[model samples]
Target: MRRIRIKLNRIPSLPERRRVGRKIMADLGIKLQMGWNPFTENIAPKAYALMFETLDKFLAVKTKDNRPDTVRGYTSYVKLFKKWLLEHGFDETSYVCSFTESDAIDFMDDRDLAVSARTFNNSILFFRVLFNWMIERKYIKDNPFMAVKRKPKRLTQKIRRLFTPEEFNELIIWLEANNVPYLVMALMCYCCFIRPKELSMLRCRDIDLDNQLIRISASIAKNEKDYTRTIPDSMMKYVRKLDLSNPGHYLFGDHPMYDFSPGTKKASSRRFASYWSYVVRPALGFPKELQFYSLKDTGITNMVNSGVPLTSVQQQADHSSLAITSIYIGKTDRASEALKAVDIID
Candidate 1:
């Protein structure tokens, strides 16, 4: 075996040295002509390194811009992709540039079997962003994900089970008896038609008690649109009773079970969901699917059943269209009775 030696006049920077080494290896036929380097075969492929480096930069920018959810979501998708690759016998040294449309399809197919349609769609979206970024940086000649098509999402009719007035009253009693710190949050969701995540983002300043209104900033809103909703008279009573010494404090400030640092303005929805799953649900005997979101459904349905106009319900629910709000208004025995009453004999 003959070892080829090359001497340079001066040492270059680490990045420059890597480039020089790759070129030298290529000239000697010791490396592949592809984007990957066989000389660094023990280490991960250059494509993987570039992909991860770009991901790191992307996540840093997103975090600095106060988009923590985006950071978390992108990180999750990359991790899932890496895991899928490893499961299919591709290790760390596998060339990410070798990723093809078929590879992406296989990953999606595998994911579809294990997760929901919405989750699979989210995974595809993440890949689209990642590969597009890679293409922009010349990490790859083309975006492989662009060639992959998402599976058609099944049109499953959403059946939102709303809490009856009796059930809601019983839940309130249970919450009070248990001294649940999330009682205010539950009340806001049920009365104001606020999503759990939106409720968690509320601060004292966002609430105008005198005017009986709550403002949801664009950053916190799901649609990224700033909107204000009038507080229900019942909810206003609870707001008045709350301690508002600090106008900047979180509306539902941290509890032992679900809390952030004193200076933190918002709580994590995952933490809130954990509290609901482990503590609240078991105590109330609620089913697994009857989550915190059910409160919002219960509130909107209650209003519509009580004869609130469809347009009013749409505004209250922050739905973009009345068609969306109509889904929440489920049929009731009272509705059946009304139909019977309106029926005329021939």
Candidate 2:
């Protein structure tokens, strides 16, 4: 099997881009035979069709949160995986139940694609989930991904992404100037130190503006336990000004500014990284690697630096283990307090 890396030449203007795209598609044909999947016993065409249809049905019916956009993304990922698998000589007709841990590991290692470890991990996890679902539903007798542990490399880069005072001010000004909502959707996770996924299921009614508190139901929180975080007094005015007439409306409702629908909101986490790249970073002149999750990191850092108790931040951050919070706090000047018996040699 031949491995080819796709290279994008410098992007031309929109008109030029459209012309290039059309020409490329024309050259490739509407549906050309890429490779054959032996599992279907048919040529490439039937196997590819079956793979897509299977993925669509699985995502649409299996996901706990059945948002349209979420399903759409899973469909796209599965398609990309199928393309990769075929090009790499993976059989499609034999149930994925025949696969093993080594197969999975080799697949990741052998790929010429220059993707991140996190992305590779996600692809493996997606396959794991897919196989698990298939096994449970009797589509297959066993799950191939059960013992396939994804041992990802340690994240060496200390995540240094947060809005400085100047950057934050620029973000606000840009939003206001463009009539975008000033409510920092990303900041809710950071300032309150909640998980990004939890923010998605939040409803307008969950917030108590009068009491300056936001309650997250146990059902939606990452820890699966009910917890409430108080909205700081400083942010109350911003909360008060928000329109919350629709009880069913999400806190991050489908605002025109964000171009989000309920479908978009469910898939927001997947899109959050891209949002910062195309919109937030460019508008604020920040680095390309800056992600929305960095907002949470900054929030935790500021809270710790300002002498907030680690225990309190842990609870707010919904960390199951105190050790995790300690890692985030790192070594602090307050370490002296813990070292009561330190002796200095002359």
Candidate 3:
């Protein structure tokens, strides 16, 4: 028998002790079903903390290094998950520990039925990573999303597109003639082949017109590797237009009254989404399908077609391989096509 100690309001008589033992025995079956060892564990009361608190703790540690946009995505996903848990009664004291792959699928099916393949895959990644972390620290016994299948991108609701010359010219004209502050950002995306996330982490110090280079340090780069993007001489006229006096300020941010402003801090890539929705999308009358990133596509396509070396475009794109760059080149719009054409964003 195992030695155990119990504290009570008063010394219990033998009859009272036996009565309490019976109650404990009855609860043990339920505890076992919940993945808790009632005899050896008493952690549910403090650890679960009514579910949401526990989830918040996980997020605090897990998303600390994620980009602002990614953090927001994770937070929103968690909120929806928590609401689902409350509705489905998964918020019980030890229900989190009891979660299995079946429950994970149920949540995905119920919440992600109509989401895009990218969104569905990202959600699966989030849950798998979240649960793996939990399992590592003994918070749970298994990863609930370990076996979930990814939705095929081809089958998902994707709005694939390429910018026609007419559309591209119209957009540039609109930017030059209005207060589209993201014009410079769009130019960087198109000209220098930089991603919005990378641009968000950029400071004035990174843009060196004198050297015709933009530096991406490993800390800020998505690939965790240092990269240098050349500032084409043709684009220098536009690059020179930026206010680089304050080397510490973010390159594409610092709108004085903007909600997504990263003033004195790193801005979020999410600002691009809001800017596109509230500003550019309405002004240009562009559909949701024509993403700002499509500018990068136009640039890559223009370069490869204009006889720029495959390896050269690959390096400029910071792509891991030529294969990926080739894929971008494969989806070109000749009418809206190259270097002379892109001449554009972040």
Candidate 4:
């Protein structure tokens, strides 16, 4: 028998190689389905049709658990990631299971370069939750995002400054004079230590003016924990005077001044921010770093300075820990005065 020798020329092109590899893999998969265990091969892992499918399921579960804000955040982050993946040559058919730690790291690094530290850290956290969900459901063997770390935020003594009594009065006067619908919200935040979003989402029935208490429902609370806040005397009369013909109506529903339609629709965080940017900020003479959130800090800080125990102030603010409440206190003259009262030589 004569043995024929074959001569090898140039190797196949990259695309040709890929096509050949895919054909081989497909044949292997078909054979495995037929129970032909060649070389005792491991079964191929199932992959999602698209990244969005996994995201949709994750969001559904989060929503069912009453974590709307978390759902919104995760959705936004995943959408951004999807867009980034597409821009970088990934397509809808790409398996989410194929995503690697390097991919997550690259995404985080790119985002960190383009955004603030807080935003960058938020993206990291979002991906951590996302991949953990994938792993829990056996969609992936491991979380690729586990390797990513959050960027530490710089500690600022005054992250947001507490409003002085004069500044608070000026704000109230401006809101009243301009007929801004957020006047009630501002007062609620300043006096009752209610978060803007919680106050905005309050219903007529949420308030018990007779008892001088406002109940923040778990659905609207930031921490998803319901708590009652005592309504300050200054805001009691105002709360009682609100039109409660519809018990289900939003306490701070739409207003013509704020360009919102009057209805049961809850006031959005965006609308509140817009109101601050265009109206409140300018009206307050553009006070340095002053924001609507300052109302909560101002209220809590005032309580602390007015001889209210830190524990009491923490409870009123609904803070999970005293450490969180301390951040709002900043450096008050009252604290200095109290410290000055210590006579070492007396």
Candidate 5:
């Protein structure tokens, strides 16, 4: 029998201390015989896994359970931290409790983590999550990243304005003339209001031309939930041009340039951005603020301006609430024209 005697002073206000004890006791399945001894006869200290061993265990739990993209992201963060750990001469056999708040701060301040505010913030969040997982399993007493501050994160890329009709038409003409591979993909981003990542995961089978609905799979979806997006009436003629007869084939994927054939393999989600950055942006002399994602904004604006119901817009965008749809709706293009009728300062 293992006996633990702790006179925890001011435990009423020290909820963290109480929480730690509760977590460890619950995780080890130790029903306290004495009501004070958290470590029951079941738990063996010798059987406890080391730091590296725990990492392997964490990965084992995630590899089969989590999404591939999620797993990859977590793995990359681990690799970076592992590299930092190795550089600082951290022993792989050290217990999770060996890591301190200062150590976490140093890791956060590491030059490699200075990529962007979002990346740095995400790294902190990842560590917080990892340490919390460790704490739950009785590997650590506290989360080190809890002391590490997150930098202000603004998604600069996503803060986009709507595209003008003139620029939009010009780009389409250029795309058609140049026989660009991203032609269909670019149109889908606007017409279907699909994000690049979502479009990259699209298969011919996912699209129902008969019903004019496109199914967003749970695996590749941003929200990790299944969604159905409508193909607007105007887009039907354009969508029908594609050979979506091959149910197994990718709608916009690895295929010959200008061929517009169903591809056997999935294409990179970054292709749209790549083309916009190198080809389209340069040729059109578009400003830095005019990103490729602006099409989704522009399209949504047009849909609302054309008298599409707000509820329908909310559903089509796959937003959780109508408020999010309203945020994107912003000041519509026709708002200026409509405001002209109302004379101010009468």
Candidate 6:
């Protein structure tokens, strides 16, 4: 029997106790045991420690079992969701019981500011995922999201704003003068339809300059699948101009890029996104409807306008399904007025 006495004189708070218990469980061979009261007895201590250790185990399993970047995203979103839940009077154990569709909708309604349906839907998805995880472990009886109705049309609407050629030129020039590595990263989003998370893990070894292709390993992609995408030839010259002397180096190394928050090892997509929200985007005098992802939309639009087939563009964009590719092409078609059509209109 291992017995070490800790004095009640310096007893920590509940959260701190949980932390210390987790550390003890991790460092030593001790396990948590909980009976009643939750503040006394070996059973309660062991159970308390087990709960936290299980969360840690779930976290580790997620790290190795899922894509690295996805794990990071889940951790961030889950942590935020947990904080939001606690603030709203929903305890951790409450998640183990399936939440009603109304419960979720009510939660969204409680937000003082009106959030876009997509944004609100995303939060619902986080809870749905959490509950699904709970169900898988027999923590919950069933999934509640299965019954939630689809969000309204107003909330589901997408704002499609392709950058005008003039705006695109000005945006590029501004970034170049202002020194933002995000400029090149943004160009990659346009040129290749590469997601921001994919770009974050890009390494020197993935580029094949001779073939003008970038191999996005399944390891870093959102879809848990590997794909090789062709880079737009228009971007080739500048890509060649980039310093690739250090093989296997990050394309965007730590530099004096515009408003780069220092000490972050990799450029966070969220932080890069803030640049659009605050700086380079505002300088161009674009409206709120115009978005950063619209660069990818612009690329697709450019392809269709240049007479590239939808199927061909789909392959280049590395979309898994034809339906998704069709949506991209269709959305771009709506902006055809923004592009010049040489079809000889009378």
lDDT of 5 by residue, 193-268 (tens): 8888888778999989889899998888889899898887867766777778789888776654434346888776
lDDT of all predictions, in order shown? Answer: 0.69, 0.60, 0.72, 0.71, 0.72, 0.65
Candidate 2 on 1-346: residue-level lDDT in tens?
A: 6332222233346775565456544534643455533343322211222344455568768566754546766777777767766776554432233344566566666542556556666767777788676656544554555555565468435445665667666765775455333244554666787665667677778888878778999778665678998787766665665566766776654444455333223435545555666776787778755566767776777777678898888877777777888776633323555457767767
lDDT of 6 by residue, 130-152 (tens): 65665566544555565655577
lDDT of 3 by residue, 232-326 (tens): 88777766766677888877675644433223566567877677778887888998888888888888887887778999999999888888988
Task: Evaluate residue 43 in candidate 1 and report its C-alpha lDDT on the 0 to 100 scale.
Answer: 29
Residue-level lDDT of model 1, residues 218-248, one tens digit each, is 9889888999888877666556656666778
Q: Candidate 5 regions off by >4 Å?
A: 1-49, 111-113, 153-159, 224-226, 256-260, 332-335, 344-346
Error at 293, model 6, angstroms: 1.1
Worst 10 residues of 6 by lDDT: 42-51
CA lDDT for candidate 2: 0.60
Model 2: runs farther than 4 Å from truth? 1-81, 88-92, 95-106, 110-114, 124-160, 169-182, 257-267, 270-274, 330-346
- How well is each residue in 104-179 modelled by candidate 4, as lDDT tens digits? 8888888978987777776777788777877777667677778887665572144567677788888878876665
What TM-scores do the predictions have? Answer: 0.75, 0.61, 0.74, 0.78, 0.78, 0.68
Worst 10 residues of 1 by lDDT: 42-51
Q: How far is candidate 3 from the true structure (C-alpha RMSD, Å)?
A: 8.2
Query: Between 4 and 6, whose TM-score is larger?
Result: 4
Q: Between candidates 1 and 4, which one is better according to lDDT?
A: 4
Query: Which of the two, 1 or 2, has more TM-score?
Result: 1
Q: Count the backbone clashes (under 3 Å) in each candidate.
A: 0, 3, 9, 0, 0, 11
lDDT of 2 at 37: 37
